[model samples]
Target: MVEIKRPSPTDLLTIGEVVARTGVAASALHFYERKGLIHPERTAGGTRLYPRHVERRIAIIQVAKRLGIPLSEVAEQFGTLPSDRMPSLRDWNRLNERWRARLRARQLELERLQEEMTQCIGCGCVSLNACLVMNPGDQLGAEGHGARRLLPIEDEVPEGVGRDSH
Candidate 1:
């Protein structure tokens, strides 16, 4: 079980509070609110007041976006919870479960990326001078979308395997 650091104990959280609770920058919280994923109320003096749930939601949104989940997908998940109102423990638990699953996938991806990069960092370093990357026809980003392949390829298909069964 993960424990969120309660940076603010009061009902109202300041911009800095949001930053600490969400591990997001204060500017990002403002941007997300402007994007309508988070709605913070105003005080009599016009200070922004966010329910504690917004902190958790912002954390979830940050992770989801880092994984390249679209804003619509994050919105759909936010719709499952009561935004204007504080969430019950059950609601928080449900959010935690979803987050843990996403984190697990992200963890696996990072492990594989580490392996790929470690392979690329070999002492021989001859691959750097190889013509393998000199071909104008070859492109790595063209092979896949999203950040999953931001690292180098660890494997490529065998030659002659593209022949159709006859």
Candidate 2:
């Protein structure tokens, strides 16, 4: 895998540069700004000016989105990030740790789902007798009668359900 290098402190990045570095679209970055997850300043010419830290934040935001985390949750997970300054090491570390845990949980939940799917495929739905899909841990289907559920989960779970652990 290729290593991602952080830009030097002296290097200020444009929104385009940040986009290129993070592999996130400019529109997505704008969406993050609207959600208060990331922000870039307006230049005198009205272009967006971003710091190197913003690139890092964009990367984090993208991964969180891929894990099905809504922008609302991401904002809650990370307190307001200031647009006028560089993010501190402590802030980055705390955010990184939190997101990593969320991603890990998401991976585990997905693994659980995949295993149940494999069981279903192999045992001809007989394992649905014990699987989370057919028989969740609790009276999950009691709330409503439907083909599917409003909430995908059959039981109450903490945030970031499916995560991959190394």
Candidate 3:
């Protein structure tokens, strides 16, 4: 009869071990599983076993969360990785580059918001009828409804208005 060798416990981490090592709650790990972000192997007794490398994945997810990157975007980026193995250093670099671009865009948007926020909120009308002074006869209404000025403009801003006008 041939004898089979089982992998050492160190090769696979149980859910509790993963929570301890990653400093993530077990419920969060389960949430990640449900979101299809991480895949773990199951034991005969219905135990979950994660590869040691899952800690890296959890770290990446946490960073993305901290950056306000939506889980859907994280999942999309993770989709680019090979499912069979841990992400390589090159893979991590690629993810970093992608996230950096998103962060830059977010920073610019936040700056724009900060510059405009004072005026937007000052009137208390919040782009309603009282905003006619800034908007002027509902000219912005021609473009669209719902705080058109607040929306990001794709082309040159309309003349005779905006942050510089006031």
Candidate 4:
């Protein structure tokens, strides 16, 4: 009879075990280590061993990637977490709040883009020079050239500018 060994909660996991459990590629794990996103201990033979909490960290990293957040930003956020121990629920909640704001802003920008595209399609006049609704008397050119409306708005819209002006 073959006996299957079950890992205890306190036991450090091998790289193979982590890959199997997290469904992340071994290459990706190595890349994360290289990027300073995760820190694992090395055995006398140089085998990597990850703490149980690393699974949670990898999950956070994967979610950030899916949301289009840069790895640099992930590293910035991770910097706030405690390195000596697993992150607490409160720590995770703080990160969630920050990411939620960014995601909300992105969602609003996408919605704005969708509305502008719908207006452009409805007019059937793709000519920017003749489009009075989008550009009138080349006013946007005064703000510096190249798709002025497509640029991300950082502050209050200027008077006689933007979709609201149309």
The Cα local distance difference test for each model comes to: 0.70, 0.72, 0.82, 0.86
Candidate 1: count of backbone clashes, pairs at least 3 residues apart or interchain: 0
Model 3: weakest 10-residue lDDT segment is 127-136
TM-score per prediction, in order, is 0.47, 0.58, 0.67, 0.74
Best by TM-score: 4
Clashes per candidate (backbone, < 3 Å): 0, 12, 0, 0
Q: Which candidate number has the best lDDT? A: 4
In the range 1-166, model 3's lDDT, one tens digit per residue, is 9999775433789999999998999999999999989888999999999987788889999999999999999899999986557778899999999999989999998887665666667746655544644555676577766665555773567775675665
Collision pairs in model 4: none
lDDT of 4 at 45: 98
Candidate 4 lDDT, 1-166, residue by residue in tens:
9999885544688999999999999999999999989988899999999987888899999999999999999999999997647898999999999999999999998897777777878979867765655765786676765677675774657876776655
Which model, 1 or 2, shows the larger TM-score? 2
CA RMSD of each candidate after superposition = 14.3, 15.8, 12.7, 12.0
Q: List model 1 lDDT by residue over 6-105, tens digit each.
A: 5442367777777776778878788888777888888999888887767767767877877777877677777788776766789868866886798799
Candidate 3 segments whose C-alpha is farther than 4 A from its true place: 1-10, 118-166
